[model samples]
Target: MAPLRLSLACWDYDRVKAIEDGRVRPEGIELTFLNLRVEETFFRQLRYKEFDISELSLSSYVLTLNDPEPPFIALPVFPSRMFRHQSIYVNLKAGIHSPSDLAGRRVGTPEFQMTAPVWQRGILEDEYGLNYDSPQYFTGNVEPSTTERTEKVPLQLAETVKIQPIPKGKCLAQMLADGEIDALESATAPSTFGTHPDVGRLFPNAKEVEQDYFKRTGIFPIMHVIAVKRSVLRENPWVARSLTKAFASSLEYAYEAIHARGALRYILPWMQFHVEETQAALCSEGNDKWWQDGLTPQNIRTLDKFLEYSFKQGLAKKKWEVKELFAPGSLDAFVL
Candidate 1:
């Protein structure tokens, strides 16, 4: 039988570099990898089902689960995860010195349903006692925009919350710099902050804050998950395990490259130091596998918390079990 051929769309992350370079191949499969921006991939994949497999926003993915017939089902191979404390940006003049100060302030997000904003908002509300509906939320691009961006998924906002688009030709970054919006939360750093001195992160010592958060909550905030089109999965159910195995192997390759101390593969001079720091911060006392795959206890705990937040924030109609989020074949190891 001929090997299955599939198109896979995802960002150029180190963890998936082995798969991209053809060093790791899925069993009985040939892949054409589309290296693209995360937003473009998610938009195309979610809106058009443009690829056989693609990276999806966790928040957006949860929204789709509410649909009676979702077009995609995911594997547990998370391509992107990060601590979102640093995602919150604020104008120095906004009088928002702390997360609590965000209450009753105007906040902007690139998309209402984006994963980064959802994590940040959830953390703020849960840890700092900020009400979910306290802020007047604005949705749009982060740069000097030509037009406002719209939500990719419908939202059921709290009755106390008010959300509107930024005026045409306006954007979140420009609004924050001008004090039109008190703050903005996004996965990417706002472009205006690089040029404007007045714009600063809400948590200046974000690393320390994030480390504390992880220590307390044990969540590394999953941003994007790998999903296969339901039609493709239905035709070749074995493809799920094959793809998961390949991705897990690819992550091992990434670990080797990052931990190769003889010659640093990454650009940063302190790349090894950063890796060691990350391991120390996130790993158990004697274990260093901080980024393990395959729905481990830690990952499941994180996913459950995320689902709780998603449901509470109205991105998900109801709380979904972690097993329901991934293909059945992906939940356990297959004996060879």
Candidate 2:
């Protein structure tokens, strides 16, 4: 077989796990890795067909699905992985404890159309009737494809809620600490915020929103997905299973490695600033960690929800039967 040609575009978070940890090595697969910011560059790449497979936001999937050309499909690589919390956090001094307190305060998130922000804002609007910022009025990147535009709503409400975008991961925490920004996207849950001294705790009312939102929608806003192009699947059908197997193996390796006595020592440096714990808590249960048990039907359902949302939100150009997103039995392969 000639060298299999493929490229993967992923977020900074997954890149560290796949590359630095030696999990998704490119040596045997003829894979070229692409690290991209999930921003305008993301849309530009899709428009130009620069990547064979790339990670995309659930919201982006929804927006792009509406487009007529360069038809793409989303595969369920890791679904509803709790990739991060994307919560609402305020500075201790801000005197804010609930979503309602956000009335006139500026809130910072990773992006304008990011899953976290959309979900958070949706909860505020749909439930609490809190009006979020207007498309142009907010501080974050307002990409038409990824974010929704609400028109004719009270401009006062939109202007009152400020949306500031922060860089991914640690930068999000650092900005909260330095007071460069107030509140966080809260992508990671408790254990993550506990790692930072400046962040006191998630907004007191966040749980209600999460629970109520999940109850009504049957899905949470996803942070990111390991998406692949439909064309790639045609050229390398077996690659999907190979990746599924490799990812399963990697998860097993990460789990055993973290649980093993001395393994924590090796993983510490690799996950240091990226994750908060010392060598002792490398594998402790919390935050957006990978699953050792591998993917499942529920995972697929979660991915499907995002794709469905993409279709409803006009992210995907056309609707796809779930099978179109995966190999014939990739779903079954992961389950067994």
Candidate 3:
């Protein structure tokens, strides 16, 4: 087969290799992975057909559904490491004691429509039974300073939370430290950010979320999914199936290897983030409550539920059924 050219916007050098090793077609299929963030630049490339595949949030994808262009294959749901666990953090000295107290508080977030606020609010409502009272969003200004640039996405949940545009260049951490915002919807691992002395926790919602998910459903909600252009899949269906298998197999391999004592030394080299720290966070903060290795029917259903709620919240314009979104043969009966 000819070499498959692909573009993975997210920079997960280690994780991609793990997928390539496990899932690429014909064993030794050449895949060119480009390191780029999926921003307007990516959309521009898609219009020019400069790439084959890219990662996209479901909400963002929905906004472009009206275009005459082909749609991307929503790869098997990979529960976001962040949303799989909800970590409700607040300023320690704010005197806020519980989720209930967060009701009128000024909360900061990068995006409202994105997963950050959706899942964060879910935690507050579903678990703590508290209303965060629509978060205050920070839409980094146009030509925002470096700081503002980092937080530019518009708020999807502003109706649920207040929206505030912090000037560019100001560290969100500093805002948290100075009590400008009581909390931040850190959609990634908490360790992704430096340990903040001011940002203490009332309830480590990340751990609580996993527990709550397991109690309600058999799996944790799926987060980010590797998206493929639907036209590309129509031309080559096997590629989609192969990619799904590869992703699941890679994750399974990682899980098994980590359990086989002494493998950490070998696995450490492939990790982009600190291996020990990520591993520790995985162990302490990891949500295996419903993880049976990789994606499962329950996982897909969770994603559907999330999308449904997102659409109602206006984060997404339409509801994409699981069968319609995922590639055929992508979801196997048994989790690896």
Candidate 4:
């Protein structure tokens, strides 16, 4: 039989670059990797079901699970994981000195259902005492000068959760900088973040704060996961296992690239020092430090926490179990 041909739409990140560049190939699959920007990829994939496989926002994926006939089946392989404490940007003019100061503040986000904002909202609620509904929300592109944006997945939030959009031709970065919004939560910094003296991070020392959060919670929040369309998955179940194993191999290759030390794998001059420190901090009892993708206990706990956030925040249509989100046996390893 001919190799299975599939087009995968995802960002070109180091962890999955091997597959993108053909250094790692999924068995029996003729892969066509489309290295699209995350925003474009997500918008196209979610809005139109435009690709055979895609890297989907975790929060958006959860909401889609509520669909009567969900169109996609996810693999436990996370293409992107981020700790979101650093995502909170505040206008200094708002006098927001701490997380508690955010209560009743006007906040802007690209979307209420974006995974980064979901993680940040959860952090504010769980780590601090701020409720998810504490802030009045505005949604718009961080720097969209003309085009309007919409939620990737349809949302039916609780009535108490109030959210609206920025004015047409307006942007979140400008809104925050102008003090129209007290704070902004997004995966990418608003355009005015470092350039505008009036805008600063709510947690200036977000690195230390996030590390402490990990030490306490063991959750490096997951942002994006790989998913295949339900039609494709039902026809070829082996595709799930094939893609999972390929991603695992690619991730290990990335780890080795960083560990090689013969040449700097990343741009940072102190990359090795930080890598070693991260490993020491997160890898007690021999865990992988770079947040490996799989359905291991650590990942399960993390995913479960996100599910709770989704359900409580009214992002999910119903309370969802973690196992319900992924393809059967996709996270398993076959010993050779």
Better of 1 and 3 by lDDT: 1
Q: How would the candidate models be sorted by TM-score, starting from the highest? A: 1, 4, 3, 2
Candidate 3's C-alpha runs over 4 A off are 1-4, 13-15, 21-29, 35-50, 62-70, 77-80, 83-86, 139-147, 150-161, 188-197, 204-209, 266-295, 329-336
| Candidate 1 off by > 4 Å | 334-336
lDDT, model 4, position 130 = 92
lDDT of 2: 0.51
- lDDT for model 1 comes to 0.89
lDDT of 4 by residue, 1-336 (tens): 999999999998889999998999999899999999998888888889999999999988888888899998899889898888888999998989989999999999999999999989988999899999988999988997567987878788888888998889899999899999999999998889889999999999998998898889888889999999999988898899999899989988788788878898778999989888988777877566556777877889999999999999988877788889999858565333
Between 2 and 4, whose lDDT is larger?
A: 4
Which of candidates 1 and 3 reaches a greater TM-score?
Answer: 1
Candidate 2 residue-wise lDDT, 37-116, digit = tens: 66534565555657876766555554554455434555455433342223566667666665566666556554455565
Please provide, for model 1 over 1-336, each residue's C-alpha lDDT reduced to its tens digit, 9 standing for 90 to 100: 999999999987999999999999999999999999988898888788899999999999989988889888999988999999987999999888889999888999998789998888899999999977788899898887565578887777777668888888887888898889999989999888869988999999999999999999899889989999889989899999999999999999988988888886878999978888999999998788888777888999999999998888877988899999999887764334
User: Total clashes, candidate 2?
Assistant: 19
Error of 3 at 305 (Å): 2.7
Candidate 4 runs further than 4 Å off: 334-336
Candidate lDDT scores, in order, read 0.89, 0.51, 0.55, 0.89
State in Å the error of residue 173, model 2: 11
Give the TM-scores of the predictions, in the order they appear: 0.97, 0.58, 0.73, 0.97
Residue 6 of model 2 has an lDDT of: 76
Candidate 3 lDDT over residue span 1-336, tens digit each: 565655545444334556544343423234556666555433444455455666665555554553456456567645244443444557777777877777777776655555555666766666676654544555332222443344222334435545666765765556766787776665543331346677765566656556556656544555456677777678676676666666655566555555455445463565435445444433335554324323445666676777666665665546767666666756562334
